[model samples]
Target: MSLPLYPEPVMEGPHGPPAADGPVNILLVDDRPDKLLALQAILADLGEHLVLAHSGTEALRCLLKQEFALILLDVSMPILDGFETAALIRQRQQSARTPIIFVSAVSDSETHVSRGYSLGAVDYILTPIVPEVLRAKVMFFVDLFKKTQQLKRQAEERAQLFREQAARAEAEASERRAAFLAEVSQALMTPLEVEEILAMVANLTVPQLADVCLVDRVTDVGTIRLVAWRGSPAGPVPLPELIADLDPIPLDSDFLVAKAFRTGKVQLLGEVPRFLDEISPRCDTGERCNRLVRLGTRSAILVPVVRGQAVEAVLTFAVVKAARVYVPADIGLAESLARSVVMAWERACLYQAAQEARREAEAANRAKDRFIAMLSHELRTPLTPILFSASTLAADPTLPEIIRDDLQIISRNAELEARLIDDLLDITRITQGKLNLSSTLTDAHRLVLSALDVCADGVQRKNLVLTVDLRADSHMLNADEARLQQVFWNLLKNAIKFTPTGGEIQVRSFNPDARRICIQVADSGTGITAEMLPRIFEPFERGQETSSEGLGLGLAISRPIVEMHSGVISAQSAGIGRGATFTVELPVVSIPMETGAAGPSSGEGGDSDAHRLRQPRILVVDDHADTLNVMQRLLQRLGYAVSTADGVESAMSLATGEAFDLVISDLGLQDGTGHELIQRLQWSGKRIPSIAVSGYGMKEDIAQSDQAGFAAHLTKPVSSQLLKATIERLLALQ
Candidate 1:
């Protein structure tokens, strides 16, 4: 329908019903007959009955008989004017709240309008009212009065609805909580059995969360047994007599769990305590002494377990132990949560038990795997030397060439095996930064050259093009010579192994401005991708589709060696399909410092590099047949009475009983280390110089040799030149 101009909901006529009618009655008071008639016509058409009285007293009489919807009065009336009539109407108990409007010839100034309304009129209307305006105004009041009535009804309805929603939510929460409680009750009601609850709690929970977890079960004697635990012992502790033999223990404070058990009401311990009552105890001593009352609990929640409407257990969370206190809503939530746990304990006993078994089995499997790995590593360490030495000798070009290339290769392999074993032992030590370093001063350049010499065979076998360009500078440096050499050789060998046959490899060296020399080893083969770049230096990290053909440990071992030398090594590459470069920057200076080398170069250290011999007598001794034969031949070739002995007794017999200028003896023999023999011979006043040779050069071995009057100590893999100089130096003292 097209809307009517000034459309309004119509009201019923006056005298419409009994003493209390559905529609309100209105009285119109106006001295002007036309104005009164106009208002009367409008009210009639509006569907509201109009009661018109020319004077104020007449209106009062009509109002006394029945309640009116409103009053439309002329403010300029001759007697008992609109404002005055409104006052009289308000004086009546029934019409006090009755709305009234003043129809006036006077202009509506703010003061006049205010005063007219203040005298008890609800509104003011200007004279010569249009028919639509009159109908609209009267209809508006009639509609508002109806709305006010309707609002009161709706408000009551809404209040009832809110109460219903709240009650329903509370009932649902209670039912779930009851289910949980019933489960807990049923669980405990059964005969006390040693169930797998401990493992269940650990696996189904703990570790993933919870800093502290403990289980408490009370005995009739009132002792609380701490049956199980999942986290640190510092977690919430249970009381021995927790509400023991008592109905509801008095919690004195607002502790959420305590209140739940004490008052049987759910409480949420939150980021902040609600008011004065719900906080927990604060200790002034012991490890938990730091709790601040104002700051609230370190833990966010404390939920009580109720069984048979009796407090049975408690669960606590430390969200605030690391952060903030839980809130009341949070406390309410925890109360519900605790209720669920209690019910679960009461209901799902079998599931919890099965979960516990699974956890135990998994733990056993992990332990088994660890044992196997440890066993494999330990077994491999010793077998490496035996296997490598046997293979090298059997593959010899000449069976009679003892102390030749094959023998040197065997020595080199044995040392490599020793180093691998040492690294394995020190794995944990290295991560903890507690690995010790036995440092010395030596030439960085020479260290590189020595390592290259050992690895050259592998490079040649690969048939990769390799070049070394060492800078012209002081090769002297203060470092761990053995460690730095390992670093260089590892990188160099890795380059050779990864690069394809006939692939070019370049080694560059320069005084990186004077303080350090940058030695970069670059290869031309499959390059490392950006994805694999970061983890290449980590121990035991073999790349996916690896190009190198050795143990994954080479680069890992190299990093530590370079760091120990007070230098840096870095690996870089463009991407896959391009080659990689490993750069080693080592510190250097002119003079080498004091080191533990007793001998010199075989063909490595420069002339006058301590091993530059001018003919010297020497003694070679060992219990092992192959080792002795090889050493004797190697020394003879260097032109040195390389006497042989099977044991320290014979070696000493030759030393003190003969005219030997220098002595070299194995620390181990058919007897024990030759420490006692060396001591006895020295005490006999035979001042013969000596050097110690051994397969094992552990810390104790070095110390014992030093104390027993050995002029120097050289581990096995003893080079020909180093052996010569050791003898020369000791004989020169004579």
Candidate 2:
């Protein structure tokens, strides 16, 4: 057979080649067209594509175009026979593994079959081919092709799925890191003790970031000490000896914790064995290495807790007995936790400092209150005698007019000095919010009139034109009578002090509404300037022209007292020299069904002849000799039999032996307090009604006297009329 000089065109479909799952091609090669036709008919039952190649050259072309499951080649061909074609097909890279079967008529020639097998043929068939055998052999290769294609597709799908899962895991890890830092920051916002903050940091680090955690704090002396430590519950328990050894490891040494603290940088050991090998030889002994090995430390990270320019502490985290290893991201997380601990420590320190400062301020305030009380006592003790002597001498009708007038001035001035002292104490009470009030169903009109009577002398001295208008229909109020009198007196006194001679002073009261009553004191003298109106009620504040007169506390004390009674006090001025108007507005209450009898008026000597019938015997006690002597003589002049004592012992002896209707005692005594004297007397079966006459007139002092069984608490430098009225009332109750 002569071979063709050139190759023939191979047959193919319009769309290049069939898909992997589509029908596989089977090549049929022969020198004769009839032989190719016969071979095609025999393989037709296999239900797969069979391509026909007239010569070995055409068959080689077919292999180049598309893949095939098997090739059936005729042995004796004209050019490029089956053996030669198969050899060439095997040489090509794409079809090197394609299966081949040779068909020949020379069945007995072993040389021809041996040559075909040597060229990589699977089978040698004689001509007169069995159709079933041919079909069965072709079907086997077709099935194998389909299974191989299925495996390739499955592998590609699995690779794509793996990529997606890796992306999701990275995203989740980033989210977890952010959430952990946020949780640590929120917990550190509140004030926590330094040790507690360290413990919290260690506890929060385990299982999430590390298997073991250790926190070291720098002490006041600048030595780093491990303050808190924690380990995961699932981790192996460390030996007690190892923990003790770990704590004493000097953090300023060459260890990782010390290095991080000294440099204020993070230290990470990804492989503990490698780090151990590097450091084991430098150590004096194997003790440190043994501890690290026993801890099962696989990886570790150490970060410094830095504040300002200094490292305050160091945080250590370790992964033990686990496959996990510490990475760079863990170093960042450790540093974040360290910062939170530093902030918490700072806040706790500030809170402790603030608490200490508050305690010191309270102590100083208490000391100031004590000093004021003592000064008031000393000043009032001497004035008691002066006030008693002048009032007694001024009351004598036979005294010359000039002498009586001089004694009246001394009395008025002594009273004025006492009021100034009371103002000092009242301002203290106001600032402390401890002012106490004794409330009753009081008529505001009565208090205004009484205040007017007290200021009558000052009004006369100034020769000011005074107009009184009381027109309030609902003037009754459930209020503190004495405090209201003080408020009214302060306004009227201020008006008398500021008004020049012949200036008009008008006092008026009227109901602005049924629920409230307004009392206004208007002056036409040196009026307040517009600039001074807002701060007129602040303590120690005074008009520029009137700053030389008093302590400037009258209006300051009045506003709070009025507000305490559910009222408001205000001032208005048309400018200096025109006049100022001070108005007080107070809530009013309706009259009750029945009215109780009014208590005896203060400073009233209430019919001495009527008191002389009973001849009430009173015991007066005081540490001041002058005050004691004046009080005894004053009581005698008021028709009461009085005995005196200088201290608690003498007062007790006098009260127990004598038959007294009232026992009046000063709160401060040389031997003991008047509170002790009254209690001792009552314990001795005396049971006499007593009154507290004290220079210590703070509300606490008065409460102490009342609790000690005193019938009344009368502040020192008491008037004879007030003393007489108090004695008569107590004796009458007896």
Candidate 3:
């Protein structure tokens, strides 16, 4: 006979009822086909999968392929009996828990029945099987199996849902942590006062991270002080009134804040009352602790703000609402917030220090400017007389050529001394970034020649060979003439000083492009070393030639002057003995259509015949006796009726008594300044044309003189011809 095949079971749909466990398989074993057929018919009323096996071995094979709710076994079989098959089925894990019932025909003895039951059988029946009992037993086991599968599925679903909820909660916590740190970082980055920073720190931690916040700072006297605190606005009492009675306490007490500071670590208390009592017995009676308990304090954290090895302050946070509690993770966050506060405090201190330093530096700079002005005035006063007398005597025709030449030398040296003083002032202006340029359309070639002329004495003294090349077609520039000449003079002077006797010096000018002009001053002198070449333009830097003649400010001053005119200056040298070349590049401009007429030439005294014809009465005032005497002789020789005074009072007396055509007054007078004298004379209705002659030649000084009603302001060490021309112009203007 052929065994029947069974179809695979269908799974229940997702929306099926809870009790709908679908179908289950049942296995039946009998050696006789008739008995198997009988059992299948008996269980046909119950709707479930029924698998039929002919022999015990066939039954075990059916158990291997599918799970069954119940197994029906016949005791009498061919090769493997019902008891042996049942033992083997129980040995296999899948069929071990399956309910088994034995069906027997002739094994009616008590011993045989006991043997059938010992083989893991649930029931034993005789040859004429009871159909109703068998059907009821199979249905009972099928229902139990379906219910067990349903419980297993429901448990798995619940576990998965719990995992999803945990993952979402953790992600939200991480997002909140990131946002809080970002807020703290932004708030602490700006410059603020120390107390304000502490207060900000305390205010930032409330409601979100804690219900209350307090900050304690370590004082310089080894004590703790309550610097800043904040309480929740939702608390029972008003925030201001709640903390009104709070005060700083000594660190000797064993409070959490003090303990955190002493150990330089965080102190945490999950159970506030118990831990408080353990740490300090007096905490139970302390007002602060009593207040915290009244507010329903649940947990607290104290983090120390440590800078290096020292504790600078302590931060306290408490959960007073009882809904939240502090955890280990919160300790890390508290420490981070504390660190931000410490960094902000340090930045504020540094900012304050920087402000103080800037003020001190500005004051020092002002003092330096004043000292330079005064020193310039004092140094220039003496040279005025020397320059005046030398120029006067040198102009006399009766003197021998040698004597006249000697006077010229004295005058030239005095002028040289004056230029040195100007350099000192120029360097100071350059460093302060206040150097102003008076730009005009000028010929670079002319300024180069003038600079060469200024250095002619030194060149001739050394008997050096000089070479000049002016090949540039475009050499005109809008620049400061005097300052440009000063740059060229510095380069040539350095070349002259470093070069030995009979050395060669070459100066060249050429157009590098249609828009730019280049000038090179090369000398066969003691060349600069490679090491010093980089810093050659630094202030007070000199070559290693052992020459101590200058202050080493020439190159330093030259670089900036050239740059100010939209130009570049550089130096190149082959080696120590190979000579050096300095090159300057400047932007050229188109020459103007017309050049203004040149002013009256310096060093040419006024027309004596015209002055003698007018006999202009002039009053000269100076505090220096030699300066006054020189002015008197110089003016007298120019054919003017000159009167001299050594002070402002004498000058005023002379001015008021005589009808003067012009007044010349020194700025630094015994009784008053030239500015005062000029103002006084004008106030007294003496409308005489005045010239202010002073050693203070700064731009401010000249401006002050102009404001005082002086027609002109002249720096001291003025040449005789310049003074003479100035007086003639003023008198002519009157």
Candidate 4:
């Protein structure tokens, strides 16, 4: 806590000053002039400038006007005693600490003598003083005082020299900075590569120009790319080449860079821009606003580099190093340097652009790579549960009844995996313009009912009271009804998920106008916060909630899909915990019923599941005992005589030894995907319908299954109805 104040002092044997060389100032105080005269002659051996006083009051008056290093006083005096008089001499601030010695005829006891010492007296003398001892003590303190004064004077002199040196250094620093900047201006027009220029600027620009140097440029896609930066890497990472290749941001946008280039004027930002597009992360404007600015990047200026009447680029400098507002000097040099860099860039535009393009592409490719990696990781999360269940079942058919429960989990997760895969595929299709819509004139109400039916199981699981309000006289719409069903189902499914248990969800539909029908799904769930509401539709962006179980691509995909069908889906919420409403408006037209004509109908009974029965000879192979028993029970219940086996060897032996119409085998067996069984059956020249069943439903897994000659691809815990139907459908087709 304490800084060094002085060097440590060393001690040496005392050496007194020569008395005959000069007279030193000495103080003499007594109640009587006779006593002063008596004390003065006693110390005459030591030369002294005697300051004499007849009383304590006169002595104080004498000490105040002059500096005295020594004082000799009587032990007894009037008004203030000798002890008090000596203390008074020391109390004068200037002479308060002057060494004082007591000289008296009284034989004082220890207590009385101690009182004299306590009053700042250095020595006590008897009535008749011993001249040698008195002179030695006075002379010793005198020489020490003079030596102290000499050292004090020297310290002051050195401190004065230091001040002068510091002032000169500061003045020189200013001149050198000015000269450096002037020299840089001369070097500016030199044709140096960007790296060399950046390195030079990054290293030297601080005192002359900016504390932070950042290059913001337009990307090829017309999005602004933060590029090549020096100082504060905490802001968005910049990709320089991408910025170089980008098209200038739109003039209408709220980016300061755009404003600077548009008017060929420098636009200084003191606060975040007010436009929603500039502030919203969902805007896709790709411009940074307040968040970065708040983190020490306030008071930025965007200076345009103009040539002729066109603005080719913009350079921005913001205060980032300190909290103080930037002064004109801070950005003055940066603006000058920007002009030179712009000149070099423009002259080399034709040659440098191709290289810049490759760089921009590489940067964007990296962004896409990051996006894909996140997507793959998210998609794989569900696959882990499914993959494990299938492999566990295949490896040991002797599993407990719990395997049946795990199977259901696998099927649900598989469905979720399918949806995520669909989203990824949609991304590719969107970029390539390969999206296809299957349109038909279908009952709009029918689709809503179907969505509800698909989501009914999930709704019940959450214990929600699901209600559908349909205006039932049927309106038809020219739409991709199946896809619309999916969109509605996803929304309803999400509502059910976020809704607390025992909450209510209402699905309502009505013709709002001649051109559109409004279908709404309202849920009593934790409503989206104000911040998250706008961006809920951005692909793979999980807003606000850290605990949300989703890839965040659902609404993003759903929104576009709905729009693709010439409909719009929009959401509304007050705030978190207040619930939310989603409405889809699809175009519909009223159609008149045709006058009765007989319709062809010659099917079996209405109450029969018989229309869907193929009665295929089924075999279910899994390692788990519970799965084998459960599948055996489930398959028999579906009216198919079924056989079950666990492990690759058992499955292969059964597969080769007996004929099967359908083989439902787990992909991960004791050894591997039921490939062994497939190989055995093929070797015997007995080809049977096969369904590769497993919990792993990743894109790679589905592809692998297809490559391995699977007839139907299924993930475990597939609903009993789906399992029966898939098998029956395959047999019916055969």
Off by over 4 Å in 1: 1-461, 467-478, 509-517, 529-531, 544-549, 574-577, 586-621, 633-643, 648-656
Could you tell which candidate, 2 or 4, scores higher by lDDT?
Answer: 2
Against the correct fold, how does model 2 do in TM-score?
A: 0.71
Provide the overall lDDT of each model, using Cα atoms, as 2-decimal numbers.
Answer: 0.61, 0.81, 0.82, 0.66
Local lDDT at 199 for model 1: 31
lDDT (10s digit) by residue, model 2, range 518-588: 99999996777778898899998876554556889999999999999999999999887888999999999
Candidate 3 error regions (>4 Å): 1-142, 220-224, 230-237, 267-286, 290-300, 318-322, 349-381, 395-398, 428-434, 452-471, 495-508, 522-548, 571-581, 591-734
lDDT, residue 504, model 4: 92
Model 3 alpha-carbon miss at residue 432, Å:
5.0
lDDT of 2 at 429: 90
Model 4 lDDT, full chain set: 0.66
- The better-scoring model by TM-score among 1 and 3 is 3
**Which runs in model 4 stand beyond 4 Å of their true positions?**
1-441, 454-467, 472-482, 497-504, 539-551, 576-578, 588-616, 621-633, 636-655, 666-687, 694-710
Q: Locate the minimum summed-lDDT window of 10 residues in model 3.
A: 1-10
Task: Between candidates 3 and 4, name the one with more favorable TM-score.
Answer: 3
Residue 92 of model 2, lDDT score: 96
Provide the global lDDT of candidate 3 against the true structure: 0.82
User: What lDDT tens digits, residue by residue, belong to model 3 across residues 340-418?
Assistant: 8878888988888988899999999988888898899899999999999998898799999999889988998898888
Model 1 Cα lDDT, one tens digit per residue, 415-527: 56655555553443455454456676666667777877877887777787778888647567777666677678777777776778888888778886768878888998678
Q: Best by lDDT, which number?
A: 3
